[model samples]
Target chain A: MNHKNALTPWLFIGPAVLLLIMFSLLPILVSLLISFTDIDLIGLGNWDMIEFVAFENFIALFQDPLFHRSIFNTLVYVSIGVPLVIVCSLSVALMLNYMSNKLFSFFRVLFYVPSITNIVAIAVVWGFLYNMDVGLFNFILNSLGLQNVPWLEHPFMAKISLIILAVWKGIGINMLIYLAALQSIPRSFYEAADIDGANKLQKLRYITIPSLSYATFFVTVTTLIGWLQFFEEPFVMTGGGPLDGTMSMALFIYERGFQYNEFGYAAAASLILFIFIIVATLIQFTFNKSKEN
Target chain B: MKNRFEKLLITSALLIGGFIVSIPFIWMILSSFKSEREARTMPPTFWPQEFTFEHYINLFQNLNFGTYFTNTLIIVLFAMLGLLFNTMAGYGFAKFQFKGKEAVFIAVLATMMIPAQVSMIPVYLLLNQMGLTNTMSGIILPGLIAAFNIFLIRQFMTTIPNDLIESARIDGAKEFRIFFQIIIPLSKPVLAVQAILTFVGAWNSFLWPLIVANDQALYTLSVGLALLQGQHSSSFALQMAGATVMVIPVLILFIFVQRYIVEGFNTTGIK
Candidate 1:
């Protein structure tokens, strides 16, 4: 290539590459470095005051009860939310795929509304629905002669409530992913199954389910990573409240780093969360690979 | 008869499911129109006892809705600057042969795995050092060039015939001219998809803006609404109104561009 031609490409890409390095690439290393130091708001103003106490923050994070609670909460969220989202989204996709009517298309859009809407708005609305006295959920239960349930007040219930909202918000995109995958499956496979006198359930199990494996894998990874860093729902809904019932690792990081000004400690917690995500993702990849073999 | 029954069963199931999925949105919009007393009433009336725009009025008058809306618009609009630069980079990657290209592209892709939360604290500190904290630029700067967008655009551009660019070059056309005159027109579909996705993401973004812009005057709608929920904890009507105001624009945008958004998801699988 000519000198001018070689320079031309750099002209186009240089600005973005610079920004990416400054903002994204640099920050990862900086945050990692920050995790080892004893940095707080005061230290931020005076860098000399920050101490490089190696592994101290990490060790403290492991011992801290609040950190333990956040980890457990995040685990509960992923464990419940991932499977429920996949199953529910796939089920909805299957049901929608069975019909091709205009009404069903409308329903497809309806289901997707939550995914696109702002999470804070969703949290606020759901918070009202879960309100103690005049909430719609309790109102319905009262009409049926059942007692009111503490949706966000009880620690255990708060976790479940967050998962429910998360699943609802999450189902749309995964459903569409599955729907796309489902639509791509060749009809001949199902037709052949039918010709062999295979019932609907058998066709679904043997043909449809097997065909959706890749889409399932995709959904599982994305949703798993998403729920692992579960923050916005609980952040807006509970503020990790009711005795830290719904404190996600992401929220915990935000609370420690920003709320308490414990930047190094929060950085340690965030790094741990990042490691958990990478490990979880790698585990899924290994399991999928093993299954394929 | 069995076929008809099955169809009926499927439709009813979808109908019930759709209603259940829609209840939150339904409740939000309906409650936004309800008076404070009616909104808070036990065994809450599904329909407003009386239609009222008072909460919305209150949102604008008392809650600084106008400032929040304007701030959100500024951030989203400024963030679109990334799209231009990303498209240029994507084209460079797709069409040009350059040294260390593979390494650079892989580096960009690797950054995607590092979740935003990891970098957020440092980014905040960086902004603080630059005296950008509490500024709209602080919120807009970090999101200006996403690796995913560059990746998406490059993938789309690779499908464009190289012969078109080569012929332009043979005709003594400059690279920038070929890009603007020939390549850009062809890449409109991908550009549209990126623009829509970027707009939705910037509009709905919360945590970063919340962290960066602690000044109330700089709050985006999402951040403002979250704070509103906390400040007006008992004001159901006002909170619903704030939410309604925040959600309506995106919903309207979605209705118009629903096709491209869904198509974007199908093609990219990133949403």
Candidate 2:
């Protein structure tokens, strides 16, 4: 290699490496430092005004009922949202795989629509759908001679409503994932099952579900992590509630740092969320490993 | 007879499911065209009693939809710049020999686990210090180099045979020429994947734009729509129109490039 060529690789990778360091790597440490201090709007303006109060923000977070509520709400979202996403997406994938006509391809595109559309727009449409008096959902209920349900009013109902919308929006990409996995499973396995006189249910149980284990794991982990940081839907739809019923950890962090100007408090809250995510991901890894063995 | 029955069963199930899935989108578009009085009717009409474009006209005239659309386009355009930089890095990682290359690549992959929320506060502070806050650069800069894009491109480029580059170099091609003339053309499939994914992500991004652009003039479509929802909570037709305006472009884009977009997602899941 020539002298000029020795520097060629750095020329290629320099800009991306610099950016990754600036926005991602450095900020992780900076976030950790900020979490240890009391940095507010005034502190942001004047660096000297910031006070380093170690663990105080975390201590306060532990005692804060609102933070507690946010954590509980996040758990509720992940628990319900993750499973519902897996089941719905997997079922849709299995159905799509059963038929390979033009109509099925069209259905695949239709089902994938919500995944690509802007979330704020979807939230607007869904907000009207969840409207108490004249919403389509309530309209259907009343048409059947039933009372109107408060989709986003009652706290539990609000969580359920959010989960329903989430599942609706979330199933598409995962369904595609499962479909890809399904296509890759060798046809000969099914041919063998047929030779053994396996029925549809028996074939699905012994062959299809086992073949889909990795896709399911992938879908579950990604979906679980996504739900943990859930913010946009609740932020846009409920503004964290009729009564703080939908406050996710991410939204709580935003409300603290930006809305309340409690940057340090919010940083601490975010770090806790970060720890929760890392721990959750690690647990999932070990669990999946055990299942495989 | 049984085979035909099974086909009928699956088709009906998919048809019913597709309708249920599309109801909100259908309702949004339908309601956007409804007259204001009809939009608010109790037990809402399935079809508009009187279709009109008044809400869309109002959105353009009064709501600053033009500014929001322009801002969103600018962000997306700048974000596409990342594809070039990432592809360069991906090519370097895939084809070139360097010290600590594996370590650097693994580090890039590891950063994917760190949530954007973790760095968000400091990034805001960093931008404020740099005097970029509330500017288009503020929204554009943080997301300009995603690790995932670099990873995707590198994996794709690895499959291109190294002999193509070696032969071009033997014919007196310089390093940069080899990359631009030889490698880039071969990498089009992955580049298409990267471009479409980047365009969709940048266009639909909300939280970063919301955080960085406190100025209403700088608000992108997503933030603008959220603000519209807040400001006009009772204007059912107006909000629906705003949403339709935002979604129509994406839906159209999907229809045109649905294959590339779907394949891009499948690669992410299966790879």
Candidate 3:
């Protein structure tokens, strides 16, 4: 009876636990160990060919200009993209709060379409929009007698263009999150604010923003982590080009690992990317925790 | 008067936001109907002057979209089976109390924070070792049970009343029977939620599929669309048609299953 009791849970969870350990947990450990070694494609099967590099890969990455540039571009992406997405989504969510049920659901679905659509498809569509000559944006500029901007060709514009696409891709999910958060806030708080003669902006600043802090934290963390691992937009649309202008850390790691077959180097880069995610998330938690007190 | 004006302002803002959000999709669909010349013409055509199905024809006839769609179907099918396995594990966690249960659950939850990229290389190597590389199984294996999905199912299963299970056990019902007969039928909403999410995710997945299966025959719709874009880089209408084909199914699924999708995300996310 005791043995059966012990075995019952395992019977249910055994497959999932086995797979998770094999795939997720084991890979996590293997990757961490691999990050410490010098192992490439040829050394993949033959353990004898691998060497213990022990921080050499990390040191090398720190000195690599392209790696440095990738890190800088990722920071530029996160710092700008996270806040921009949050504000846009929040504003949309706030506006959405005013709509009737039928209208709100309609607009909600419209806003969410892009989030669910694959990023590659979105990139292709945006590529056409950002085309140098006959693109819609340039056509609009021409109509307004403004000079046609090289949206994806120029380095500065390319970064901005990539950020724009990221922001567009992200807004739908965050908007829905914020909208749900907003809907959960009790009406009594707003009633009290109104009775206290608080204006719209005052109510917003005090009640709405404070109510959204958790959602804001969630969004900021996710958006920051997402930007740190940014790959798809630049991969598809720009190919990390026209001058490595839109290259992100994720794309950089992918290029080194897959394209160059520098698996060891890519593993090291992936570890660094993991460290950035942890540090960023920890900072957000610390900030939120302190704010809570 | 103030209230009415406020309402008007809010409506206008939402309309503008909606318009901005829909423009690219609208343009993609519109351009799919335009001729190659019109699509690339100066001051690009917003509405195709004379609509045609040439691009759609080309997408099916030339691009082999049917194969890509079938590949995605196979991946999603296997992934759904994986979701069932996750639910069973979640049921175990939620109902059965064994040693180190809390510790085990937390460990699983913690895996959620470690991004998939961290594990990509080693997991790929593991797949290679299993001789699953370039097969749909390789693409499906690593994603069998994500921490988030396990957490989701666990959370849902915890709400199932204990007395029902106890009663079944008292009647000499085997644990598996109780799971398959009672718990699963009751957990329909969450199971449906997981199915929709898994379907959408597997359907949209690109990076893993791209890495695992390099063969043209095994390319999922997303990977296939990407490859199509590369080969027909200048064919705007053809690419748009491909995008339309890729997006339309998921969009249609969303329209029907959105309540489950929305509630699943909102509940899982906020909590």
The 10 consecutive residues of candidate 3 chain B with the worst lDDT sum are B262-271
Assess candidate 2 and give its TM-score to the true structure. Answer: 0.98
| Per-residue lDDT of candidate 3, residues A120-174 (tens digit) | 8889889988888768888888899999899999877899999998899899989
Tens digit of per-residue lDDT, candidate 3, span B112-179:
87776777888887898889989988888888788878888888889889989988888888889999
CA displacement after TM-score superposition, residue A221 of candidate 1 (Å): 0.8
Cα misplacement distance, residue B220 of candidate 1 (Å): 0.4
Task: Provide the global lDDT of candidate 3 against the true structure.
Answer: 0.86
lDDT of 2 at A188: 100
Instruction: Give the candidate number with the greatest TM-score.
Output: 2
lDDT for every model? Answer: 0.90, 0.89, 0.86
TM-score of the first chain alone, every candidate: 0.97, 0.98, 0.95
* Model 2 reproduced share of reference interface contacts: 0.75
For each candidate, the DockQ is 0.68, 0.74, 0.66
* Runs of candidate 3 exceeding 4 Å displacement: A1-4, B265-271
Tens-place lDDT per residue, model 1, A1-293, is: 33345688888899899989988888888898999999999999999999999999999988999999999999999998899999999999999899787788788888888898899999999999999997888898899999999999999999999999999999998999988898889999988988999998899999999899899998999899888889999999999988999998999999998999999998888889999999999999999999899
- Native interface contacts kept by each candidate, as a fraction: 0.73, 0.75, 0.64
How do the candidates rank by TM-score, highest first?
Answer: 2, 1, 3
